[model samples]
Target chain A: MKVVGLYEYLPIEAQESFLDVIVDTPKASGHDLLVRIQAISVNPVDTKLRASKVTVEETPRILGWDAVGIVTEIGDAVELFQVGDAVYYAGDVTRPGSYAEFQLVDEHLVGAKPINLSIEEAAAMPLTLITAWEALFDRIRINPDADAGKKLLIINGSGGVGSIATQLAVWAGLEVITTASRDETITWSKQQGATHVINHRKPLLPQLKALDLEGVEYILCLHNTDAYWDAMQEIILPQGHICSVVELQNPVSMSLIKDKSVTVSYEFMFTRSKYNTDDKVRQHDILTKATQLFEKGFLKTTLNHVLTPINAATIKEAHRMLESGKSIGKLVVKGFEENDEQAN
Target chain B: MKVVGLYEYLPIEAQESFLDVIVDTPKASGHDLLVRIQAISVNPVDTKLRASKVTVEETPRILGWDAVGIVTEIGDAVELFQVGDAVYYAGDVTRPGSYAEFQLVDEHLVGAKPINLSIEEAAAMPLTLITAWEALFDRIRINPDADAGKKLLIINGSGGVGSIATQLAVWAGLEVITTASRDETITWSKQQGATHVINHRKPLLPQLKALDLEGVEYILCLHNTDAYWDAMQEIILPQGHICSVVELQNPVSMSLIKDKSVTVSYEFMFTRSKYNTDDKVRQHDILTKATQLFEKGFLKTTLNHVLTPINAATIKEAHRMLESGKSIGKLVVKGFEENDEQAN
Candidate 1:
């Protein structure tokens, strides 16, 4: 199998940062499905993992999480999927990822791909969609009927997860208030169904007050949590909820939220797969529901850029673009290079 | 009206720490209900407020929250209770508290006292009951049927809030695991229907493992949050919920729970009343439900100590006991001294 992987961590500008290599194809076992990669997307998690690497790998380390693929084989224990099934998933972060022509994923984490969308389009939705879905529905558990017309503030609403989260919150009947600094980002946020767009570069409370919103019932923060902690505390309604995907780099004074009786949760998409929790199969269910929404034209693919002929060079370029922190929506790499098979 | 209050912050040993003084009786307005106090309980909040006071008040500052009283008057807008109704409540912190002979409370924050319990017994319940109920049912929102048999760890199971929380969790069909160090506390926790009692003074993980548990799905931390932060992170199951009433005095690394995707909430009982939230009336509903539980014999009064003839001297003694940190269950004070009226 042809794979884009790394033996040592290096900057994207270095020629050895990513390598085109050959590895023996792995077989499906237990509840695993052997998927032939069709397309994969680059996310902040990819760059973070790469940059945080401190140990040299004995073997090439694969590092792609979001993928749209065809299941070529399925283990006997797999009941959710079969061979030839087109599936999409944010693969497990603890195991070998989807930076290869073939990869293995647990059937519990794979969902039937939306038949209406292109492979690159479906690939772009998994990681960010799963993150947004779990952060809003699973963690915050916002109810559509009871919480309809309630305000939800999505921080960094132009980013990958924020774009999907804003749409989902709007779809769930919430009043979506999102933050963006630049004109392009603000337009992008509004295009995703945000009812109001405020500049993140400015004081959030003043912006919210200018819009006549005293506080938000829910806040989904996709940017720097440490930077937004105080603002979130100030603007969250008493007994409100805040879910953040970003990890805080420094110790925060959590007591600031005590007087308001606030709830703060972290939404790490990998928790289920990493812990092998009893509800791990819920990921598949969420993706399946997302697929239905996509097919019904309620959701649009977030893919903004795509590169063909998936190879070390293309994957490195995707990583570079993501690391620049200016990329909008999602970036995907599709199709394995024909010459890469000869290397295998 | 006779009230036991303070004009200045002083040590419990000081004669002026608490003073029995007379103030003009207040009239009810808006949602307010004027109640004549029958019994009042001293909680940690009373002691903390006394210690933290810096400004000498021109008007005496009353320091009591939990009360069982008779509704002597009702404002025009008050519909929850009428004159002569026996009610119990954790009065608003922003208002003059229950220390006075007559106190005005929002009718929405008051509840019909349990007919099955005595005034002293009911007085011991309000503050801790509201805190526990809000933490479990409102903040964590643990479903009785869905979460039946799931483990809940209460960090200080024999304290006021923990005692009630343990009973409530048990009544909801959850397996209640609690922490207590003293033999008396352990016995008291067991009486509250805790399935297991561990020592908070010792390491928690080993004790839980010995009890054949790897982690708990829920934790109600009733003690120092900064002290237990790391242990709570280590013992909480992935996607678990933790609610704490204690405010952190020092900054703690909250990112430690990110990998497990945990939800951490602060459950301040004063939140609704302090913020005047839309759901402020939920406190009335919670106390009403608790009243039904007490009537049905599903719950018991946690009051274990009582002081007679409510006065400045008695309040000072109660504060001294609570500040000692070894007082078990709840300490309540009942009745006004015969000579105190002359002083007033």
Candidate 2:
């Protein structure tokens, strides 16, 4: 199988950062499904894992999480999917990822792809869709019925996770207030169903106040958590909830939220797969629901950029764009290069 | 009205730390109720507020929260209670508290006292009951039916809030594992229906492992949050919830729970009342339900010590015991002194 992989961690600019290589195709067993990659998306996690540490791997390390693919084979215990099924998923972070022509994924984590969308469009939805879904419904536990008219503040609403989160929040009947600094990003945020767009570069509280909102009932922070921690504390209503996808780099004074009786949660999309929790199948359920929403026209794909002929060069370019911190929405790489396509 | 109040913040041992003085009786208006105090209980909040700062007050500031009293008057807008109704409440912290012969409380914060319990017993319950109830049912949002048989760890099993939390968790059909060091506290924890009693003085993970338990689904931290932050993270199940009433004195690394996708919340009993939130009336509903549970023998008051004559001297003694950190259950003071009785 043709794969884009790395032997050692290096800057994206380096020629050896990512390499095109031939690896033996893996077999599906137990609950696993052998998926032929159709398209894969680059997220912050891809770039982060690519350059996180300085260690040489004995074998090439694959580094993609989000993918839209066709199941070519199914394991003995697999019941959710069968061969020839088009599926989409944010695969497990602990094992080999979706950076290869043939990738193995647990059947419990794979969802039927939205038939209405193209391969690249479906690939862009999985990781961000799963993250945004879990952050709001699972971690923060917002009720669509009970909290219908309540306000939700999505920080960095033009980012990958934020773009999907704004749409989900609005679809759940919440009034979405999102943050975006640049004109393009602000317009992008509005396009994603944000009811109001504030500038993240300015003080968030003043911007929210200008929108006639005293505080939000919920906050989904998709940016630097440490930088926005204090502002979130100030702008969250008493007894409100805050869910962040970003990890804090420094110790924070948690007591600041005590008087308001606030709930703060972290939504690491990989937690279920990494912990091997009993409810790991929930990822499949979330993606299936997302597919329905997309097909029903309640949701639209956040794919903003696409590169053809998936190879080391294209993957590196996607990583470089993500690392630049200026990329809007999701970037996807589709199809194996014609020369490498035969290796699959 | 005769009240135990302070002009300035001082240590419990100081001569003028608390003074019995005659103040004009207050009137009930809006959602307020004027109650004639029968008994008042001391909590850690009483001691913490008494010496929190060293600013002189223009008027004497009374300090107490939990009270069992008879409603002597009701405001025009008060519909929850009528005059002469025996009520119990953890009144608003921003208002003058129950350390007086006559106290005014928001009707929404008051509940009909349990007919089965004595005044001092009922007085011992309100504050801690509200704290524990809010931590479990509101903050953690544990569903009794769905989460039945799941484990919940209470950090301090013998203290006021811990005692009730243990009982509540048990009543909700959860397996309660609580922390207690001394033999007396351990026995007391068992009395409160704790399934297991572990020592908080030692590392909690090893103790839990000794019982063949890997982790708990929920943790209610009643002790120091900063000290237990790491242990809570280590001992919580993936996607578990943790609620704490203790405020952290120092900044702590919150990102430690990111990998587990843990939800951490602060449950301040005063939040609704302090913020004047629309859901302030939820406290009344909780206390009303608690009263029924007590009357039905599903719950019991945790009063372990009592002082006669609600006066400055008794209040000082109560504060001293709470600040010493060795007091078990709850300490309550009953009635006004004969000499001070005429003031009301």
Candidate 3:
């Protein structure tokens, strides 16, 4: 099977960053599903993994996580999915990724794709949806039914995770406050159901004050946590919770929230797959529910940009766009073009 | 009314560290209750506040938080208790504390004392009980019924808060792993219902490994947080919780738990009272439940030392004992001596 992957970690501008190669397609066994990849999306994690410290692999390493695909074969232990089922998932980080014609994924991590949306649209939702869902309902433990009157602040509300988080938090009956600096991003955030929008470039306190909010009960930080750490500390209510998906480069003082009795939770979407936790199947359940919400029109896909032909060139361009830090929402690559074999 | 207090912060050994002063008895209003103090306990907070910055007040500042007393008067809005009702409470930090013969406390912060325990025993419980209870059920937010199979680690398991925390955690059906360096403290920690005891002086990983444990689901830190920060970070399970009452001197990086998706919460028992939150009454409910548990013998007093006569000399002595860091459980000062009036 043909695959687009990397022989070494290198800058996108480097000539040998990604390569075209052929390898034996993996077989399904013991709860694994052999998925024929249909579409995939690029996230910050993809770019980070691609540009990280150099490692020359004996064989090219595949590097896609979010994918929509068809199950061509199922392992003996598989019960959630069957052959010919269309599925979407943020596949396990430890396994070979979805950057190929055929990819293997654990059945527990795959969800039935939303029938109402195209494959590219469905591909954008898995990673961001799982992240936003777990960060809100699992890590922060906000009960959608009981959290009606509370307020949540989504920092960087127009980003991949933030756009979905804004919608989900609002759907959970929370009053949503979001931050977006650009006019286009601000309009997009508002369209995502943000009750109030503020400029993250400016100080947050005055914006909260202007909105007649003293402090938020929940903060979902999708942007730079270090830059907003002190502001988040000052703006979170006593006994409030803060969840962040962004990893910090520098240490943040836990003492900042000591007196307020605050809680800070870190949410990494891949933790379940990485740890093989008892609740790993929760991803399937979350995505299943999200599909229902999407079909009912409660959620709209965050995919704003799409590239055709799944190959090294298009993937590299997607990475370049993401690394620029100006991309809005999700960028996806659709079906492989028949003529792309010439590039290989 | 007679009060044991200070005009300035000083070392316990100083002559003027604490003084016997006479002040007019305060009247109850709003939700306040004027209690005739019978006994009071000195916690680490008292010692820290005493030795902190030098502040000279025109009126002497009283410094006690935990007290067991009789309600002498009730405000118009008081509904939880009546005059002559025996009560126990950790009075608000913003108010004149329980160092005086008569002190005013909000009824919402007071609870009916357990009839089975002595005044000194009851006094030792309120502050520590509130701290431990909130750390487990509120901050860590462990559901007692659902968390039966999980493990909890309590650092400094024989101190004022840990002594009770170990019991409560065990009662909640969580396996309790606690830390104590000294043999006496280890024995006490076991008596407090810890299933496993590890010496905090050594690296905790070996101790945990020796017990056939890989990680704890919950960690309640009552000792120095800075000292245990790294170990707690290393020994916490994926998506686990860590709660600390100790204020850190230096900043600890929040990045340590990023990949594990761990939650770190700060538990200041007085947060509700200090902020006057709408949920301020939760403390009342917690203490009321604690009283029932105490009466049923599921929980026991942590009062290991009791000094007779509530006076400046005995108060200073209690402070000295706590500051020494060798004291086990809690220390209390009993009712005022009749002839000690001459000392004033």
Superposed on all Cα atoms, the candidates' RMSDs to the truth, in angstroms, are 2.3, 1.8, 2.4
Candidate 2: tens digits of C-alpha lDDT, residues B1-344: 89999998998899999999999999989999999998999988888888657699989999999999899998999888999899999999998999998999998998999999988899999999999999999999989989999999999999999999999999999999999999999999999999899999999999999999999999999998889989998999999999999877776666658888999899999999999999999999999999999999999999999898999998989888898888789999998876335322
DockQ score for model 3, please? 0.67
| Steric overlap count per candidate | 0, 0, 0
Q: Residue by residue across A1-344, what tens digits does model 1's lDDT show?
A: 99999988888888889999999999999999999998889899888888846689989999999998889999989999989899999989999988999999999898999999988889999989999999999899999888899999999998899999988998899999999988888888899999999998889999999999999999999999999998999999999999999877776676659999999899999999999999999999999999999999889988889997789999999998999888778999998877334212
Query: Where does candidate 3 clash, by residue pair?
Result: none
lDDT of 1 by residue, B201-277 (tens): 89999999999999999999999998999999999999999999987777677666899999989999999999999
* lDDT (tens digit, per residue) of candidate 3 on B199-314: 99999988999999989899998888989888998999899999999866666765658888998899998889998999999988999999999999999999999997998999
Candidate 2: true interface contacts recovered: 0.86
Please give the ranking of all candidate structures by DockQ, highest first, separated by commas. 2, 1, 3
Q: Mind giving the per-residue lDDT tens digits that candidate 2 earns over A21-126?
A: 9999999999999999988998998888887577999999999999988899989999999899999999999898888898999988889999999888999989
Off by over 4 Å in 3: A339-344, B251-253, B339-344
DockQ of all predictions against the true structure, Cα-based = 0.75, 0.76, 0.67
Ranking by TM-score: 2, 1, 3
For candidate 3, give the lDDT: 0.90
